[model samples]
Target chain A: MTSTLKTFMEEQLPIIESHMYEFVEDLTAPTSLKEAMLYSLKAGGKRVRPLFVIAVMEYLNNPTKAGYTVGAAVEMIHTYSLIHDDLPSMDNDDFRRGKPTNHKVFGEAAAILAGDALNTLPFGILARLEDVSAEQKVELIRLLSETAGAEGMVGGQVLDIEGEKRQLTLDELVRVHENKTGAILRFSIEAGAILAGATQEQRNLFVEYAYHIGLAFQIKDDILDIEGTTEELGKTAGKDVASEKSTYPALLTLDGAKEKLAEHATKAHACLEKIPSNSKYLADLTDYIINRNK
Target chain B: MTSTLKTFMEEQLPIIESHMYEFVEDLTAPTSLKEAMLYSLKAGGKRVRPLFVIAVMEYLNNPTKAGYTVGAAVEMIHTYSLIHDDLPSMDNDDFRRGKPTNHKVFGEAAAILAGDALNTLPFGILARLEDVSAEQKVELIRLLSETAGAEGMVGGQVLDIEGEKRQLTLDELVRVHENKTGAILRFSIEAGAILAGATQEQRNLFVEYAYHIGLAFQIKDDILDIEGTTEELGKTAGKDVASEKSTYPALLTLDGAKEKLAEHATKAHACLEKIPSNSKYLADLTDYIINRNK
Candidate 1:
């Protein structure tokens, strides 16, 4: 990782974690339900989504406490998706990030409720965001719902599941990745841009950067599934090929997948260049997405 | 049902159904996902939640098209909850309203996604409601996430599931119903009042009315589970008793439960009377809740 990106993560990771934990901790929910929700939230992931949100804010030099709150909201949504995606009926994974999945620890029923609770809680968090205009809150909620709802993440999930039963064309695979993984990643950057009050042109450029990195992020996952160890990835590796799930490497050869990743990385950096901001962290974060071990 | 409510339903039910169906139809999601979502929504239910929203608007004598939109939003949340509640890991019911449950029809993964999609789409619907101020939209979204989220329906669901393992005190039973069932019902009434520009005093009274009727709704449901045939109820009757679930009749006895239902009905009616408006439909709806066979 670049020193700039490393410094950013070192300074901001705890703030992100504490903000999320505090939000979940304050919910007047059942202790067990809260625990189930917290289990997945606390389960260590890269926090890449929140990093995108905050990085955009910092790049614009318009950082605010509300950025952290929005970051927490996006993280909760990301966490909830993981919990549900790990369900027995979905991916059926028992582990994530080297720990038992939410359903594994909380039982399926509580896990489902926990996912539901997490999904419902974020909008309330966004809606109640102080220091942001009501119009912005509405826009954020609207955008989040559009990107995260069936038309975006959930719809893409359905497409991905359906695609598993067939050999999808490259276009179909790109569509799935764009919706399933790309949508929320795009939301993270766009949310930061909205919160930072970026100009329309800057916001559009950030979205362009987000799109390339999103695909890069997923392609890296496919690559890591083959190359990275289970210990390093902190989850089961090589399961993708075993499941015969359509992945970038399954369609494109490994070298071709890596080439695609680098191509997107180059394009992402180019998009960042058009935006007039100190986006050194974002630039480094793009490299981090392409090269991350996990 | 009184002629007032009968007329209201005859006129408004189709409007509510079309509003909801159109919202789902307009979504740019996968066709199958949309079908899965539409299936449960089209499955026959009393539309009680939406009725509550519109009934409140009618009661205030300031109805608008936006009322139906908000009504659609609440109904979607209600529908999503029922879909998730009937999952195999949850209630494991094979049927609902005399038809196969969501998971049975769409597979568990799709059903879960459908429920998740439904859970999310409402806030966007509320956020984009025409004629509503941004502040009101934010308030609506905030209220919804609270009442329908961890602290309310989901938390109550956990309490209910835990209660099924053993007998619960009457207070615990009430708490379960208050959060599990009452919260969203309360949201319906409150949403209506908010949309209708009701005075705070009037809104508070409507909430009291909603609280009474909310419990009454559950008590009536519990009573129906015992007395109503599966043919009438369109679901597996007597399952609560078969599962040894804690319910109003189990705690209060059938006659005692009936008396309690009557007491709430009286209280609900009194609250309606306190609001100086044409609440004939609301009053009649309260009667319908207490007296309905299914």
Candidate 2:
């Protein structure tokens, strides 16, 4: 990535994090629940979701603080999903982002409630959005709920967990990844399109880009599990193999998985080419996704 | 309580249950998640919350099917709270409504996800309400989320869990109950008022009515835990006492708790009297709150 790209990320990342912190620092919650909500939220993240909201709004020439609201809400949902997924009964992961999981630090009950609180806060935040029309806010909420609910993230998590017991074919694996991980990521990408009132043609192109990147993101994570380290990945490496969960590298050779990643990246770029916006920045974000060590 | 009141509950309860079942029977959710959600939802609730929505809307002369939307949303929150609360990590209860808890039937991870799904369903449901304006819908969502989320039900659960090891004073216990139990009940009542665009004067009166009945409801629950049987209650009897959780009967004697229930029930009726709508039926419902054996 260019120095300009890095600078853009450096500038935007903290704004996303600052908005997240302000959102979490509420008075209604007990200190513990608030602490639990803020703990993982403030923990380092790529700020990819929030950035998508902002970038999409910017691309449409309607950059507004509403993007920040939508961005913070999505981030809260993403962080909550992670907290619940790491519970002892679920992934049993002791660490995430090189720090103890929410359940590890807070007790299981508090962790669960923290996840619950974070999940519910989004609706309240979206409902209270002053910048958006009520219709738009409701639409945003519908998109978000559909992405996060039973048929989306939770359903995908179920498939992923059940897949641990046996080898899943590429199709089954795709379904799991799409729901478990892809759904939210796609929402993150296309949410900007939805918020910015992109034309159907533009929205379709963004979705096309989102789909390729979503698959590429998961394939890269599977590759990273094999090739990356605990220090670099910020979590235990080789967990897929240890858990016997199916992965791109497990089904396809490491070379083949890397080839698939490259294919998706190329395809994602092709979609970006068709868009009218100065998607040069989006292309840079995609490159960052591709080149990130973590 | 009049036979007419029994007739009212009998007729309305099934409608509420049927609506709840229809809401849960979505085509999008995975079968297991849907089953887990439906399992608790169909476990034969008394439909108190839905009835509140319906009745309050009727009292405001704006009765509509949207009350079912609000009712279903709040019940989903209530049921989700129960699912999470009954987890082995939290209350560790084995049964609810005389059946195995969600975790026991669907496994802990599914239970957690099921709870999460149910929690998210409310927003989509409320956001889709056809009868209410977008502004009213947002207001309804805000009220429901506040009551169901951290400041309301989840916060109360945290307080209740924290108070498990210590004997709480009456004030602390009431605060816990008011949040944990009373908040949602209040929402159930005022959600209709908000939906119907109640004047501030009427809203305050409804709040007064809801507050008294909310306390009465909790005090009666404490009394039931002591006086009712496992079969009668459809839940393990004396759970609060066994867990050393404070209760009205524990702090106030059984007689004292009964007196308190009567006091709140009477106060609730007085508030109902000032309201214009033939709230005589609502008054009857308060009497039932005092007289209910289970």
Candidate 3:
């Protein structure tokens, strides 16, 4: 059953990748500087962020055309964040997604410039959406900007970085993860609904579903870092332990972490129940998140 | 006569700053994060980018409220670039506008995150435009995004960093400046016209005007770096020369540089003639770019 899900995800990956690449290609600046931006973009991630976007959009039965622009926009923002995160002055990582990071290939200055370009390009993509209603598109851009911007992910990142040298309470840890990782994830689900012209109530429910799922998603990764094999989890396992940064397992006992995951997954499922019964795709997504091993 | 123009520009600066601050404040998030975003935004710069946006919008005299939203959006992008530019990994600067840079107050990670936050906030602001047709707002966001994104300014910055390490031919250099510094300057002006609903012909004229003025603005900066005082410039004097970065002075004799400035200024002035005589702002802006001192 898990293999079936992975195969399905694998199929969707190329579709998202193709659309994302098209968007990037269309928007590449007519200059050599674009080399870095393109390098980081094509440098390859799991396309997980974009897959989340496309999955949710499909779950809601929104036409791909309506959500595709903002979907690509979200991926651009995510990719840019990774590029900057791996810079020497930041995480100082040499590799990302099993490959040389953006800064490594492009040089630090060009990498910085490339990330900056990706950051700004999403808005450009959002701005160009024509299939959706103008009002819907505007709202979509607003949601994405907030999700990706300081008040959301960046602020979360700041808090996370600051928390590195200090011990954070459980609430504090949740706050950091919510902003750093959760905001965009929440946006990923809700944006699809917004573009699909989902009702306000429906959008709110989608947000609720995304919230718990986002939190669980982080906790599960913590579990995976401890238990999963190196091959299963690409880069490295137990690296978080080496970093001494807070994690779900660090704060909670193994059983406690498992309980929290169960509770959150249940809540996520409850949110899904509020959706129309026809949302088979979202149902699959909820299961995929809870059951994903790597 | 120049003082009158300077005074008007000065008066416009505060209005621009207040609008920018207020718009940033409107973004909902944790208070601390909001403060982080506002820290650099409120820190003073020339406000040239936002002013370009407003001046162009003022030219069209459009009553649309989206103009103000777009005005704030560009300022955020400009501020973000400055914040990133001041980072240690980039220019390694400590002071901007005679005060500590964003990274000095916030740690590098926080500073990087703050810059990222500011960069994405523009799209959110654009999405929240209260008074424009949704279609108009979408168009505005699209136009601004392209000019600011990798293909435009980011691409240019890449070229700039690379050019620093190697000799660039005059055409290569010009293409770079056009993308890096010139694209946003052009966007600032072009965006104003865009929000004001300038026809294609009007937009074309402004494009011509922006091109010459943008280059003239850079040329003037190169001259000022050599001739201007640190106190007046609000940045380290001769830093450009110290860094051995390419500049107009590096490529041309002082006399040659001056002649080029005069030629660009002349073209900028000629472009202004295409606008109606009643448009005093357009005429004054061309004059302002060429004649102003720090």
Off by over 4 Å in 1: none
Measured over the true interface residues after superposition, the C-alpha RMSD of each candidate is 0.5, 1.0, 1.8
Q: Worst 10-residue stretch by lDDT in candidate 1 chain B? A: B275-284
Model 1 B-chain TM:
0.98
TM-score of chain A of each: 0.98, 0.96, 0.93
Model 3 misplacement above 4 A: A1-4, A28-32, B1-4, B30-33, B62-67, B277-279
Q: DockQ scores for all the models shown?
A: 0.93, 0.77, 0.71
Ranked by TM-score from best down, the candidates are: 1, 2, 3
B20-69: candidate 3 lDDT, tens digit per residue: 88876776665666776789888876677776776677667663445556
Q: What is the lDDT of residue A178 in candidate 1?
A: 95
Top-TM-score structure, candidate number:
1
Off by over 4 Å in 2: none
lDDT of each: 0.93, 0.85, 0.78
Winner by lDDT:
1
> What is the full ranking by DockQ, best candidate first?
1, 2, 3
The candidate that wins on DockQ is 1
State the TM-score of candidate 2 restricted to chain B: 0.96
Give model 2's docking category: medium
